[model samples]
Each structure stands twice: as C-alpha cells, then as structure tokens.
Target: MFRSLCTTALLVPLLIVSTTASANPEVDRMFAEQDANRDGVIDQAQARAEATRVFRALDVNRDDERVIAELDPQIASGSPGGDGFPPDIHVVLRQATMQLRDVDGDGRITRAELQQAFVDGLLKADHDGDGKITRAKLIRMHQGVVSPAR
Candidate 1:
C-alpha cells in the first residue's frame, strides 16, 4: 500500500500538471495536454507551463496561492475523468500532495512552489538523475523494476 501510494501520489500531480502552450493548435492538441511534443519526457519548460496552468486552476479565487480549503473540494469531488481520486483515497492524496507542494508548511501553495514541485517530480521520474526524462531511460528503469536480471 505504501509503494502504491508513493507511485500514484507522484503520478496524480504529474497528470494534473499537463498542458500545452505552443503554436499550431492542432499539433499541440494532438499531444497529451501537458506534453507539447507528444514525447514521454516533460522538460523544464513544459513542467513550468503545466504547473502554472494547474496552479491557476486550483487557485479558484484569482488569488495567487492555494489553501487547503480550495484543495479539499477538488479532492473530494472525485468526478469520473476529472481531477479527483477515489473517495477512499482523497484524504491521503490531499495530504501527500499538500505536504510535497506546500514547501513552506505555511498552509498555502504559491505558483513558484507548485512549479518547483512539478520540476522536482520530473526528476523523480527521470530515475537516472540525468536532468532529462528520456523515453529509453524510463523504459530501462521500468524493465529493471519489473524484472531485475540475475
């Protein structure tokens, strides 16, 4: 359960932090909303853009920061195909996401803090400390996790 929580906790925020801001609306549209290049890797620019977008969505009051009150509802809603977790998972998800993103323990999240969270998450996914989320590297990492060679 702990491992599941760790992986999904990281993945959920990563999913929420996906969008596009490039020219060629159709082409950008073709990619994952957060992956402007349709590649599995999310570089720093993409991470920042997506983090800013997600932060804006979470702010809800046009204020520059996110508080627990704003986050609770979104986590509780659990609408299918929306930004929510299962009812049973919301509490943990909220707690983990908050703990990671808050960065200051001041009970609020600024845009920069959220952006840094996203960038940091990308590094976690990188798995090789290359400062790059390359597809080949991720595949190798996944394979090692799935079936370690003797």
Candidate 2:
C-alpha cells in the first residue's frame, strides 16, 4: 500500500506537467491568429478571412485559381516537403483538401470556390448552425471526425 501511494505521488505531478507542456506554442499562435476577436472561437467572418488568406498563399502566380501543383508543389511532385507530416498522410490530406475545395471537375479551384468551400465547411462544423465554431469543434475537425468531406 505504501509503495503504491509513493508511485502515485511521483506520477501525478509528472502527468500534470506533461499535460500542461503538451500545448504547441506555434499552434497556439496560429489559432490566436484565426480567433481574431479572441472569443475562444472562430466565427464565419474569421473563417472567410482565413480562407481568403489561404487562397492568396496558394495562388502563387496570382491567377485567382489554384492548380494541384499550387496546392503543394512537393506533394504534387510526389516528394513531400519538410512539413513534418509523413509523406503518405500529407499527400492524402492535400488530395482530400483539393477535392473538397475544387467543386468543378476542371481540376482547378477558383478563389470564389475556395471561399465557398470555407463557408460550407464552417457551416458543417458549426453543428448547431449558430455561425460560430468553438475550439472543440475545430479540434474534432482536426481529428478527422468530419474527415475530408468537410
């Protein structure tokens, strides 16, 4: 009984510290940027803004449309970049994201299409259709609860 108590005491603090330290600062910064209003959630306006920003980044040639290559040059080339994701998972995710964004079968996603996708996706993630997405919703989306269909 004494040994069990001693072990639990040692492990409890370690577990608490691990949980507290597990948060990714980079992820927090990005999430904060998305939160905009700092309301602990992202609303439609913020989601649309993020979509526009992403479209601008993807439309490198400023063509107002995103080709497969523009989405991720490395993934399109079948040679993943140092984006930390395993090559297979990165390629699959990019493919799924492309499919979700590209409504037209023409193989390109236009700026408007991207924005619409964001709106639609946010609507789907909003569950209650309240026009707001909480961090829990975002976490669920990230965990593939909604999958690529989002």
Candidate 3:
C-alpha cells in the first residue's frame, strides 16, 4: 500500500533536492507543499501521513492494490517540467518500489513492506538526529555539505 508511496516520498524529494541550488528555491517550494504545519521541517509523523496520502491517491482501483497501470493517468496528464507528477518519476517509482519493497520477491509490495520501506527511508534521510528532515538539510546532504551521522 505504502511501499510505492515511501519510495516516491524518498526519491521525489531527494531528486528534487539534488537539483536545487544552495539557496534551493525548489526545496522551499517542496517543503511548503509537504510541511503541512509550515513548521520548516517534515517530521516522521508528517512523512508517514504524506506517504499514506500518496498511496491512497495512487490506488486508483480502490482494491488496496497498486500496479504500474495506476500511474498511467498521472504520467499522461503531466507536462514537461511542470510542478506535477511526471512520467519519468513514475517510471523510477515503479522500479524502485519493486526493488525495495518486494521483500519476498513475489513481484508485489505488501502492506508490511510498505511500512518498513517508509521507516527505512525516513531513517536514512534524517541525518540531523532531530527526528525531522528539513529542505535545507536535504539540499545540503545532496550537495555534500552534510554527511549522515555515524
């Protein structure tokens, strides 16, 4: 359910953060969008909530299942370089979700795997020991200005 969502949450934000400048206007926009409380950081609870929301949105069939076809609409409706879900992102999302969340390797992501993936992704990205990930922190991590805690 949330495996793809977790992968998307990690990849999309990291990919966007990687392309941002030190000032990172893009990061600011992304933070604004995801940081529901306008608190300047995305905590684990917020990340989980977002991951769930993203999962629900992509579950087009409403069967508690997610397949590659479910992403077609979002991909088809996306514009080049627009601030919306794009085709390439979905492609990567599909592959990454399969790779990371298919724990039994049965070619499907189960609910347990989704929850684990979200926790793993959060732990990997939360480098500040603050239990939160801020846009500035992400940009700095990508820019090699900040290293993960040992």
Candidate 4:
C-alpha cells in the first residue's frame, strides 16, 4: 500500500506538468485574428498599431500615455466594450513598452525593441524548451485555467 501511494503521488504531478505544458488557444486565435494582413507573422508594426488603437480607446483622457495602474483595471475588466480587447493584448503591449524603454533611455520606442520584446516573451512562455507552446500551456501558466493536480 505504501509503494502504491507513493507511485500515485508521483504520477499526479507528472500528469499536471504534462497538461500545463501547452499553448493557449484563445490567445493564439486572438493573434491570428489581429494579424489581419495574414503575413504569416504578427510584426511589430501590427502590434504597435493594435496597441495604439487600444490605448486610445482606453485612455479616456487622451493623454497619449497609459500608466500600469490606469490600464490594469481596464485590462482586468476586459476594457472599452468589456470585450474590447484580448487580455493578453494588454500584456504584450506592456511588455513591448518595457523592452523599448530598457533598450533606449530616450523614452522613445523602436521596431527593434518591439521585436525583441516579442521574442523574449515567446522564449519565456516556452518554459519546457519545446520551441513552441500550445494553447493549453499558455492558459495554464497565465491564469491557472487548467485542472489542479490530484
């Protein structure tokens, strides 16, 4: 009985890890949908354009700047029309801005910075070094939307 219990316990975590190591379909779909030009990749220009649109819509004050505190609630509540933007969109935009800021102290953003940000994000999210993250892994990692280990 002791040996059996130990085996079960070990197996449980393995199952959980396996399940969590996948990408998020909703996120994937959002990316695809937004890549309207369908260039087989969502380039920095596309990302920035989308971000600008979202920022403008949410800024309310039209100050051309968005602070994390001001953005977080709108992001959490789904923004604008409540279904106004994908949650990950906000994350991606914020990450891009941070990367740009880090690379250049001038407070100006560049395409290279945005590209690096996206690449870095992909690398971080691909936790298992599998070169790709399925929808399930993304959801599991970000929101704990997956089932818990037994």
How well does each candidate superpose onto the true structure, as a TM-score? Answer: 0.62, 0.61, 0.63, 0.39
lDDT of 4 at 26: 44
* Cα lDDT of model 1 by residue, 8-85, tens digit: 324534443334323223223312545767666657788778777767665668889987666675554443455567
Provide the global lDDT of candidate 2 against the true structure: 0.56
Q: After superposition, how far is residue 48 of candidate 2 from its true place, in Å?
A: 1.0
TM-score of 4: 0.39
Indicate which candidate wins on lDDT: 1
lDDT of 4 by residue, 17-127 (tens): 343324345456545533657754444455455444444455456655444444444433434454445657768645544434346644533434433444344334344
lDDT of 3: 0.58
lDDT of 3 at 96: 61
lDDT at residue 98 of model 4 (Cα atoms) = 43
lDDT of 2 by residue, 28-88 (tens): 5435656887888877777678667666655568988877766554243333333335768
Ranking by TM-score: 3, 1, 2, 4
What lDDT score belongs to each candidate, Candidate 1 first?
A: 0.58, 0.56, 0.58, 0.43
Tens digits of per-residue lDDT for model 3, 1-150: 343333354454345236336546645654665689988887777666665676666665677655545545444334244344555777875576467656777765554555565555555556667778877676765554444545
Cα misplacement distance, residue 95 of candidate 3 (Å): 2.6
